[model samples]
Target: MVVKKNPGKTFEDNLQESIKQSNEKIFFSRIKDTYIPPDLRQKVRVTKNDYDCMMFARSHLFTLELKSTKEDRFSFDESIIKQHQIDKLLEATTYENVISGFIMNFREPTNKVFFVPIKEFIDYQYIAKNQIKDHKYKAKINKSSIPIAICEEIGIEIKGFKKKVNWHYHISDFITEAINTYRSKV
Candidate 1:
């Protein structure tokens, strides 16, 4: 008798699970009804003409790329609009579908990194500028290159989500903030 393995989900599934375990909190932004966190969905990806994104959540799909070095930043020589990515996304786009873009830097923790959606990158250049300001390398790109202090560049965005992080948590800080956010939402 001959037998075969399930082959299961291949590799992407493992990658997504790793990301969700480490970074699901970032994707849990309050949308409407009950919380729909990153862990809630299995992301599907469609790649065409050298562009791809993971389909996840309601009206939301995410594409992720990992950059290892600072040089990788601002280094993509591609169209302002990800036409190829969009063409695939177009098929999946729906009343509840929104494309969440991400140029992930795996070298750093996802929470510390900033990912600007493809649309935002096209619609508002300023968003990329603000997001990338996380890197305080001593290089002059332009007037917007406000010389950053060493302490300022230490890092600000949360290094990871609450539920999955393995390190310490400033419980008081989170409690205060959560109360404020939940109150505001109410």
Candidate 2:
């Protein structure tokens, strides 16, 4: 019997590959140490619209939407941000005790990271849109642009002038940082 290939299968595969490549033990370890929740199986699931990954560790829940590019930077066109993407991110925010975020992993010119809190990220998108309307914004709305803006605005992890980041280390680092930062907020 022949089997059909899922159109989204490639995207899902890439997402899982990135996660699998990253130091998952450290990711879970950090989450485990930082938050005191019941023991539960770690689950990462992909859905059509809601989130790229719905990660559950015991009772700790995290909604992660991932975007990747071979470019060296994060900034992209606002058109790339789909309505459903924003809608699902917004939905994650309403849930209590859930951490929702957008993760950008750039694979060119060396891997770079941007793990942004979803609520604040959406808020900044509006702010960025307004800023563009008010003035002639020269920047493209890409992966890194608004996220970097919000990181600076909110005093999160700063990916400064440093151009190169080791992907293996950085992915784990980003996950560790995201878990810790959001865990503190709630």
Candidate 3:
């Protein structure tokens, strides 16, 4: 099924809606930043969570960081996904029945979404770094970005469908697959 594009709705919104439609037992909550006035910015410091949303499904907890990029690759630099976010996701994996990772939306030529586990992401980063360093001139590297091709290989690709009003992704299936994959590796 084709995803019905709504210019106003973000990928996160769609995903959340999809989760809502999937099941009642699955609990999903988006971690929204507290609204602070511009004048109070100097007085208060805000620390954000590593993931955008948290899900509790079938006795398992999941923390997912959502990212949408028009480009073909996602860069690991501080400008995109921060160092603290990566650290937090990695730390979350240490706990039992906790699944943490990223839900990336590639929204350019192809509107494909992928759920990449934190461990796989870290492993890919190391490989990408070495590839760039060893073959600086020969490697087809794009500013240390993880290309969509690699994401497809290492990540669980999530399918999308058009519902009544917006595009909804297969969040339930993603959760099941993520859990199974993580369990298999462990």
Candidate 4:
């Protein structure tokens, strides 16, 4: 019998390779440290979408959506923010037991990270009720099961001369950082 390839695993490998190539830090130690039983690693699945790096491990999982733009005005797409995770769960037939996952978007040239809970932040529509500065907003996670559009590049902005002073994101330093961050969190 021919074996089927796992897209999630492929995407995760690509992400790791990209990070490694850049000499930056991307953590995979969480795979080993999972409280889930050893049998579950087999349960874990990885994949990709139009522009996402997906991973699954039991009731919770994550996706690192990759993106790049010409200038500074970049943002995350409001729709299908969790589609990768949702689809993964659907394929595994265990999504009913899972709560939610996270969506981390990386806008290129600006190694800044915007992390949001798939079910909480991504799915919600916030309506601003106030005028000018006092506008109040209410938001909710979209329960409609729509396609996950995780990243968006709205536009860009002009940086000041001081931008030269910002510390560059060295990949090796970032890799160490991702690992250390995960270590402390666990």
Candidate 5:
């Protein structure tokens, strides 16, 4: 089935449409923040939830944080994915049948997408950090950023077709990979 990309649609919008076309049983929604008026100020407190969207398919719930960057690498130091977001994702993974992760879109020069499970992401962070600390390391590693090569190694590359309007990503592939990974862990 062809999932057409609309001209002004956001990444989440396209993803929702793709999920809809992928499976009849799957449901997707973009989480929106409750608007708080400026007048409330100190009277009302709102905690930010950085999750971009959620999906329910085949009795499994998925919380996804979406990020699109034109750059070749996503920088940890630059806070492309915030600390709170990381905490939320990690927390979600502690539960059963709850798959939480990130969908990173590398745009422009490389129109590629990847679904990185939280555990793998954390492990990669540890490796990156250790590589930074090791002065005798031979391979050139960027201490602050996760380059595309590393993303390909640690994450599942989402396949897609580029149409004249936009890209039609196979989101089902991501769902399958996530479920498989989760099952393997369990």
Candidate 6:
């Protein structure tokens, strides 16, 4: 009998390679969703994690969860964060060293990205409780709910959408704005 090792690498390895190469494409290539066999899916444990990308600038950390929708809208559900992830995020937010949040990458009308802090997400969890319908959870956040100070216009055509749409989302201040709003609370 012979034993073989799986060739796939961990997320941290892929992240380091992406940083060393100064290319997000590299990181995404490694972590991007791939087709899985039914047997494989059952054998592996999948996380209901919200974040798609996370990195550190100096001592401060930023965990960015990526999202996209066919329609020109952004929606979030309570299930996006698992119990453990929620616990970790809650603990991280309490300290001055971390900035965890989500980025909605819109691929319709035009390419756009919207940033929402984890705190805002937690708050919405409570606010959205009033939006229950037929025992199902629902919430819709509009442009007004999004702050212009923390968005960006990435002028590139994002592939793999239901329709051909330009990406034009922009967020001006990333770290500074986060520091001002989130850091103060810590």
What would the TM-scores of all predictions be? Answer: 0.35, 0.55, 0.83, 0.30, 0.80, 0.53
Runs off by more than 4 Å, candidate 5: 1-9, 33-45, 132-140
Tens digits of per-residue lDDT for model 4, 26-47: 3332232124567776787644
Give the runs in model 4 whose Cα sits over 4 Å from its true position: 1-14, 18-53, 56-60, 63-109, 128-186
lDDT of 6 by residue, 1-186 (tens): 886532122223432443544422212221344556897998877654434556565466766555555445443334433445545566666766777666555444544445566666565555444543332223342322322222332111212212232111112234446656666654
TM-score of candidate 2 versus the correct structure, residues matched by position: 0.55
| Most lDDT-accurate candidate | 3
| Higher-scoring candidate on TM-score, 1 or 6 | 6
Error of 1 at 92 (Å): 5.8
Residues 96-185 of candidate 1 have per-residue lDDT tens digits of: 334334333322222233333443333233433455555334443232221112112321221333344232223223223333332232
Tell me which of candidates 1 and 3 scores higher on TM-score. Answer: 3
Clashing pairs in 5: none
C-alpha root-mean-square deviation, each candidate: 12.7, 11.1, 5.0, 13.1, 5.4, 9.9
The total number of steric clashes, by the backbone 3 Å criterion, in model 4 comes to 20
Question: What lDDT would candidate 4 get against the real structure?
Answer: 0.33
Q: How does model 5 score by TM-score?
A: 0.80
- Rank order (by TM-score, best first): 3, 5, 2, 6, 1, 4
Give the alpha carbon lDDT tens digit for every residue of 1-186 in model 2.
998654233333544444566545423311111332444324433343555666554355767666666644445365545667667777876776677777665544644446667776765666565554543224444433554334444423423233242122334454456667777664
Off by over 4 Å in 2: 1-48, 72-79, 132-176, 184-186
- Who is ahead in TM-score, 3 or 4? 3
Candidates 1 and 2 compared: the better one by lDDT is 2
Which rank order by lDDT, best down to worst? 3, 5, 2, 6, 4, 1
Quote model 1's TM-score.
0.35
| Model 1 segments more than 4 A misplaced | 1-15, 20-50, 58-60, 63-68, 79-83, 86-95, 106-112, 124-158, 161-186
